[model samples]
Target: MPHDIISGDRHPEALPLAEKVREEERARIARDLHDELGAHLTGIKMALGLLRESLARAQGPEQPLEQARYAEQLIDEAGDAMHGIIDDLCPPIVEFGLAEALQWQSRMFTRQTGIVCRQRCGDGLDELGEFEVITLFRIVREALSNVAKYAHAENALITVERQGDVLTLRIEDDGRGFDLASAARNGSGLGNMRRRAQALQGTLQLDTVQGKGTTITVVAPVAR
Candidate 1:
């Protein structure tokens, strides 16, 4: 019984220190949101405002439409970039838990990129610890980043499942895939995803073929 209890206590050795570190990390993220990300987003918004004003003051049909379209693109890019930064700073998942945060993320991604995203999760995901949650979040974040930047995907799938003592996450996309060796040599986002996975004592694998698609799988031990 004592051993069972000990086994169940994931952070027994440094619970207080872990709590303190989490708080400090959160504070750091908040500061980044306020100082760095906020400032850049504000600057972009101001620039867009000026552009809109100039476009409004212009007298033309063809050029005005073009300018307006460009302005709209700028606004959308700025908005998406700002939201992405915030999401990275304080993962929406942290406060809202796993499911809702993931749903929101999927919606935002689809809206921003016009890429369809579907997510599924096993009921057991709700039982994961905070660390596991963050780990899974990072895994998805990296996958979505690749989707946004390189996948050129029209549709993507994300699924989370629990099997015995292990939890698994899969992110698949139908897009133009690349050579893993070449990408690895160039140190792409896949490497970052792998590192994030390793940090959680997990593993991430990328499955892709040129002109086909890509699937990233992450698996880790489930904390009791």
Candidate 2:
């Protein structure tokens, strides 16, 4: 008789399969946001534009004009928010390579959070696969997010370099560092970054000193 039994072992293919599934899901959501919600928002904006024009022609009450302008502003803000969400889910890797993407992310981080952020990337990173590029991008994003939220950092740097067949990515911040043990126990962001590195068959290290700074290093084998 054949019987099924539970095992304490994990399948070797599980990690890659799960990663693929997640990527596909993110892509789908991004596409939907870009296509469906984006279209609806655009339509609303156009309609508002027409309403404003009509009100201007009629020379109606000033209050109505003000209300229309306010509604238009709200629609614009929503459109911007939607685009930001889409970009986060699926970055424009096709348009910009890994290095360019990292640089753009640094600029955007500084602009949004008022923190000085910079990036230095070594050559040969343009040849990395999409999976590696996206994974590294995500790791950097999460690290920067932590820096912004908790680090009280005045400056942050993202550096990427390749040595032999291994790629090393570092996010360093001059800020008040936290206890690694306590963060590990309380922070899901750190765990998420580690998992992303593990998905690439890499290792993640965190170095932090209280009242000094913090550095997160991810070393992963470059996919040949």
Prediction 1 TM-score vs. true: 0.65
List residue ranges in candidate 1 displaced over 4 A. 1-27, 31-86
Tell me the TM-score of each prediction against the true structure. 0.65, 0.84
Candidate 1 C-alpha lDDT tens digits along 1-224 = 00100011234444435544664597577677767877876777677677667766775566765766686687678767766766666675666667666777788889988999999987776777766676577668778988889989899998888898898889999999777656765644666566556656666777887788888888877777
Model 2 lDDT, residue 223, Cα: 63
lDDT of 1 at 195: 56
lDDT of each: 0.72, 0.84
Q: How far off is residue 223 in model 2, in Å?
A: 1.5
Q: What tens-digit string does per-residue lDDT give for candidate 2 at 30-62?
A: 999999999999999999999999999999799
